[model samples]
Target: MNLRTFTAVLFALTLPAPPAVAEVGLSPFAGFRMSSSVDIETAGASADDQIHFRDSPSQGLALNFDLAEPGKQGELYFSRQSTSARLDNGLFAPGIESIDLTIYQLQFGGLYFPGGKSYGGFVSGVLGVTRLEPEDSRYDSHHRAALSLGGGYQFFLTEQLRLRLDLRGVYTALNSGGSVFCSGGCELRFRSDGYLQVEAGAGFVMRF
Candidate 1:
């Protein structure tokens, strides 16, 4: 080759290639969640009531972004659960009024799959905020810090589609204090506490 042609070829070879695009995935899921009942205690008083919350169904969606290393990902998710509550102590009359409670959560976490591709097990840890909303306007809503740890398996149906089965244990702290269930001078004061809730579900994931 001539001198000019050789230099041109060298320059072309030296040019950097385009940056690789990151992989992203989205998963939407629906499943059942069973929560442990919380015992309400009055501060510096013996009077108390146990709030029994029923098991209810839950649903949520998660977004995943692949990291530089294979099998590692960052995720953002949201979930909601609805259920009814009953007071064990006769503090409130039975069927006096219906109380409906809804729990909402917003989370961010990381997941690591043993195998780089689909059809493997993955572990995850998430930190988020949980909000409790009551149907009765008389009672106030609460928001607290929450954490979740779990693992699951993903089965790839195709190159871009997968199914996931997951089970996680969630813990939330309830430090927001107020008059929860009270009547007349027989008012009950609540303190800060925490509770553990378990969740299991399946989801359909789409990779891009």
Candidate 2:
């Protein structure tokens, strides 16, 4: 079978069957997140070259539901998280910045909460779409299939509000037909490279 077919099957197997007994009430919430990181390694770099960084402050709405109350076996959930990145030159060129990268993810996996309710931690695997826009135009964009593995926890501040901390390891790279350029008589080429991101924030959930 092809990769797509294999992935579909893998995802199916990863999904645990619904609990036989009635499950706990699920609370869904939306929130904003901010993240920052450094590029460990990238392809096609000059000896004296650098990432030519930029400022990328992102904000997005996220939704997640408890599969079976706060803690239980065979409990799983699905979530959709998205964010955008703004790029700029680190130091070589001052006052040069651009808003060029946008990221979106659709994740499906299972979570195991050892704690009964007060607080808990979880781990999951996600597959989704990722992209980068060297330029801030719709057509001049590059897209790719991406995957992530992450974990987080929840602390109940009140019945209606809670604090959540999520950290994710993302993998994606430059696709063909896309290119990078440099000035100051510097020649640079960028191949596909994976990056890491860490996010921490709070959320307010409304249970129905």
Candidate 3:
């Protein structure tokens, strides 16, 4: 080989390689959720009925993509939880069958990490629909607009694994403009009600 060619090859080998670009990731998680009690009101009724939801388990999955800047991510997520509902009014007999209430949501939001990755805190806001499913055959399920504000912390266990703890407040608006008849032919009209659910849980997050 010529002397100039050998010098060029040596110079090329000594140059540093370019840095790797960050890619998008997907994370799937599972955790437990606890919801607060909601009030059910009826027009022309003497008092309101309270539906107490028991603490239950929840599961979800999330997609994480790059935003305009580094250390910020846009997320699309879906979660579901099932709990038993008990009527807290004296009108119902004791030991009555508890109704099953299932809640689910699909949301889009952005998460920000202040400490520049690794272990940090994040905050996000979500807007979506919340569905309430009742086990009783006579009553149909209901869906309403939902909004949530949440913040959490994430700890990196490995390069592709994380442990997360989250606390969120979910607000749902429920308005059923229908009537239901009691056993004695008395009619009860449903009214607009707001449900505030508080959830706190820890999850294991796997990234891909």
Candidate 4:
């Protein structure tokens, strides 16, 4: 983890225990996002190409506030993933040209347990923005409106501690009005308006 993320986790983990109702909870997770592909048409290219993001490890933190109803909570979630992007059909030789990419997601939404608190099966949905950053200046960072749906099981380890296992599908809506491209040698443009990612995470939640 980076300095900022490490600090936040440490601070959250050291908080004092809360009342019996569990007003709030902090969750620190380690996860990975699945690979994704985007159809692209670059200038000076004879035909269409594809930009692909390889599967990579992801890390994030979640803040949850318990609602008046049992097994219901509102959440603020954030996640980050760093990976490599490559052009399927390009001027460079095969497996030669690669770009470093990072994605950050921030969202707000709700979590619910359908069966009951003891059942542990939960569902969640969040709305937010996904920011894409390219280490190469040839392409500037861009943001897109996004949403995610998730399902998981929560296991209580103690009165104030629990384990969370989650799987999520994240979708981003892209508009042609804006674009993320390279001006130097390669120009990249998306052919579609939808981008999707699947992720799995495991973490410990501290209730307070």
Q: All candidates: CA RMSD in angstroms? A: 5.3, 15.1, 4.2, 12.1
Model 2, C-alpha of 151: deviation from truth (Å): 2.5
lDDT tens digits, residue span 1-208, model 3: 9999999999999999864444455665676776666655555666777666788778777676667776688878788888776757633323444666677888878778876573469886878888777655554566788888898998888666678777888788766564322223324444546667777766765665
Candidate 3, clashing residue pairs?
none
Q: C-alpha displacement of 187 in model 1, angstroms?
A: 3.5
TM agreement with the true structure for every prediction:
0.80, 0.51, 0.75, 0.83
Query: Of the candidates numbered 1 and 2, which has the greater lDDT value?
Result: 1
Worst 10 residues of 3 by lDDT: 179-188
lDDT of 4 at 178: 50
> lDDT score, residue 112, model 4?
96
- lDDT by residue (tens digit), candidate 4, 1-208: 8999999999999998665766788999999899668776654444687778889999999999888788788999999999988877673233447778899999999899886463288999999999889876756678899999999988989868889999999998877535445545545566768689999999999988
Model 1 per-residue lDDT tens digits across residues 1-208: 9999999999999999865553887899998998776766665666666777688899999899888888899989799999876766744433444468788989999889988754479998999999888776555677789999999999878767789899999898876465554433425444547778899999988888
Top candidate by lDDT:
4
Query: Could you arrange the candidates by lDDT from highest to lowest?
Result: 4, 1, 3, 2
Order of quality (TM-score): 4, 1, 3, 2
What is the clash count of model 1? 0
* Winner by lDDT between candidate 4 and candidate 1: 4
Show the lowest summed lDDT stretch of 10 residues, model 1: 181-190
lDDT values of the candidates? 0.79, 0.46, 0.69, 0.82
Q: Which residue pairs of candidate 1 clash? A: none
| N/CA/C clash count, model 4 | 0
